[model samples]
Target: MIKRALVILAPGFEEIEAVVPIDLLRRAKIEVVVAGILPGVITGSRKIRIIPDYDLGDVLEEHFDCIILPGGAEGAENLKKDIRIKELLERQILKGGWVAAICAAPGCLINFGLFLSNKFTCHPSIKAEIPLSRLEENSSVVVDGNLITGRAAGSAIEFSFEIIRQLVGEEAVKEVNRSFLSNLPMLGSIRKE
Candidate 1:
């Protein structure tokens, strides 16, 4: 079956973090649903506006293989404040689905009181807001069980590759990177090797 992903786009989401994963996952044949937290056109931190394929409420009852979160400082904060986002996160996990967050977006997970484990990474800028013991400081992308987290916008591609790997397979990742000509493919980390 084709994997499905719900990408929650808040008012100030990071454009690259949101788009790269959406692009690469679609290239890998995953069904991606770009959903806005609110209705109509949603604006990013850099003022890029997007018309989401669906609104968050429309898909609350739908089952997705994964839920993706993209971060901007304001975007993360916006996501954190939404009770619906929290509901989706909890429901996704309860139903054995995955959740991915990048940059400050992980702050939403942390702030919402979900994924209380000590194995995630977010942009260092938000470190002060998170407990130090839970921070995976060195990795650009950290995958802890069903939760996938990435450090920042620069790590969005890496973060996405990991998600694709989790949903599809390593071969799909290789094909995706090869297709994208990604210098940072979905193989074992260059930093770790």
Candidate 2:
């Protein structure tokens, strides 16, 4: 039943972090809708332009089963600063929908007051920015309830795999990993609360 997911992209989004998960998820038969937070095309941190599949204003909140956020200083900041985006994230969680963010995107959760006691990780630069009591270093992807997060862009594969497992199952994740020739652990670290 993992049919559709929403990947919200903002300007200055990390190209790899934003695209890889979308591509991987789609390859795994998960429908991913790229939602542009801004009006028109969005430019990544590397200045790559991506036309979103839909604008945030155009989509209904109840249709998606999950929402994934990518990381880049400006991108994450933009998502965090918008009241509407924060409200959507909060609603997604309140409705028991899956939510995942990688690298600096987890800071958005902290800013929106959603990172409380959620074991997570972000880029090293923003490590100090998150409330220390909630995050753990050296972890690949930290899935605390519905909130799943990974450290840096380097962990995007693992992050995406974790999402695949949540959406599909361990067998599906393993098959995808094998198809991609990935030798990394089939599952990411499961941090004990």
Index of the highest-TM-score prediction: 1
Cand. 2 Cα-lDDT: 0.84
Instruction: Tell me the spans in candidate 2 whose CA falls farther than 4 Å from its real position.
Output: none
Residue lDDT tens for model 1, 30-64: 99999998999999999999999999999999989
TM-score, predicted candidate 1 vs. hidden true structure: 0.95
Runs of candidate 1 with Cα error greater than 4 angstroms are 189-193
* Candidate 1 to native Cα RMSD, angstroms: 2.3
lDDT of 1: 0.89
Q: lDDT (0-100) at residue 65 of candidate 2?
A: 76
TM for every model, in the order presented, reads 0.95, 0.94
Worst 10 residues of 1 by lDDT: 184-193
For candidate 1, list the clashing residue pairs, or say none. Answer: none
